[model samples]
Target: MTTILHIDSSARPGRSGEQAHGSHTRRLTARFIERYRQFDSRTEVIYRDVGAVPPSPVTGGWVHAAFTPPAAREPWMVEALAQSDALVDEVLAADIIVAGVPMYNFGPPAQFKAWLDNIVRVGRTFGFDRSRAGEPYWPLLADAGKQLVILSSRGDYGYGPGQRLEGINHVEGSVRSVFRYLGVTHAYDAAVEYDEFGDERLLRSLADAESATDRIAQVIASVRTRRHAA
Candidate 1:
């Protein structure tokens, strides 16, 4: 059975109509999950809400433990790396990953960054080979052939290719870069923009984003079906 890792990094919580309004990305991710379940009932989902309960940031000791060889590591090192190990295991087991990311100050939120720090570890997701003259940093996790779907919610518009705010839009680009480094090449994004401008533009953007989510869900379902058959 295909295993999907669903992660939501939106800080907002509660219902959309509530005083503590939920984020657009959270709603979009829910829509995607609903459609995905309709496509395949047998699929298994592993959900992680980083925004609600963010992982601890990597510390100096954590770094030392990660760099140390497993065989030579002490019990303390092993304990220090337990969380990161679990996070990497989840990714390695997943065939697909769906992440809900809300842009915060032109970049990903602290919760998402903390998760990234936990997952990207030496001798785990990636490997370094100094003997290989060039291109020493090789990704070990690339062989999994996983697909990544990102649901992004932005307050402003023009963040796409050749757009006015493209240069400043670091959230999407940084996400792509980090995943690409870990061997995830098939990445897709659906974004809801013009959120700060609460008007017809916001409504239109939400509609378009919902449609994009539907399309992505369909594509993922089709590919999964084909892979399973093969």
Candidate 2:
């Protein structure tokens, strides 16, 4: 069975047309998962709603706890890292991670950022050794086969690679960088733009994004099925 870690980070509780000022990213991720499941029946989805209940922001205590060796950590440190440990376990247990993150300002919502902070822990998701000849930091999960699919939304246009506003667009770039560091080497993204202007352009963009999501799901399902059979 394929295990998918489904994460929704949009503050909006519902999908567009389903709720007032609903999240476009939520709609895209829902469609992506639904379509993906049609291709494979034996699938397990672990849902996490960071929007409604976000992970606690990393504090000095969290830092100390994450950096300390597991066996050496004190009781307080262990308590501090409990949530992060759980989050990392969920990521490690999944073969695929599908996240719905919306652009706030130029980057992801603070809620999603907190979730990233929780999971990207040293000695957990990454490794550090002072007695190394080369670089000491390495991704621990690099050998683990995992894929990341990000569905995002934006209010403005021109955020694609080489686009006019690409330099300022940190939404997908930030998430991809974080996941890449966590050893999610394979990644896919599909987004909807022109959200502020809910006009014909928005409608067209949403439609296009929906099609893109469907195609991505099909492609991923094919590759996963082949791998499973192999």
Candidate 3:
């Protein structure tokens, strides 16, 4: 069975139209998973609500613990790396990751950023070897065939390729770049824009984004079916 890791990082806990001041990203991701379940009833999902309880930020102790050799680590080192190890395990087990990360100040919120920090652990998601002169660092997840789906929202608009504000938009770009570094096979995204305006444009963007999420679910399901048949 396929496993999906669903993470919602929006500060808002409710979905748009479901509650006052709700989150669009959350709505999109929920829809994606809900629809995908129709195609594969046996699919398993691991949900993580980072928006409600953000992961702890990476501290100096975490860095030292992560960099140290696992066999030589002290008790304190193991304790320091505990949360990161669990987070990395979740990513390693999933075939797909569906993240709801609303743009905050042109990038991801502090909670989501902290989650990223916790998962991108040395000797886990990535490997480092000082002795390997030409390639000291490498993505340990390479050839893992993982996929990341980023459901996002923007306060304004124009954050796609060659769009008016593409150069400045860091939300999806940063998230995608991080997963790529970890060797995800594909990174997909859908976003609702004009949130600050709250005009007809916002409504239109929301509808389009919701539809995109459904389509993404279908695409992934199709791939699974083909693989099963093969």
Among all candidates shown, the one with the greatest lDDT = 2
lDDT for each residue of candidate 2 in 1-230, tens digit (9 for 90 to 100): 99999999999989997898999999999998899999988889999999999999999999998888889999999999999888999999998899999989999999999999999998789888989889988898898889999999999998999999999989888999998887888999999999998899999999999999999999899999898789
**Candidate 1 segments whose C-alpha is farther than 4 A from its true place:** 15-20
Of 2 and 3, the candidate ranking higher by lDDT = 2
| Residues 1-230 of candidate 3: C-alpha lDDT, one tens digit per residue | 99999999999979998998999988998999999999988899999999999999999988998888999999999999888888999999999899999999889999999999999988889888889989888897888878899999999999989999999889988998888888885888999999999999999999999999998999998887888899
Tens digits of lDDT, candidate 1, 107-155: 9999999999999988888997779888989888788889999999889
Pick the winner on lDDT between candidates 1 and 3.
3
**Alpha carbon lDDT at 125, candidate 3:** 93
Ranking by lDDT: 2, 3, 1
| Cα-based lDDT at residue 10, candidate 3 | 92
Candidate 1 residue 105 Cα shift, in angstroms, is 0.5
RMSD of each: 1.4, 0.9, 1.0
Ranking by TM-score: 2, 3, 1
TM-scores of all predicted structures: 0.95, 0.98, 0.97
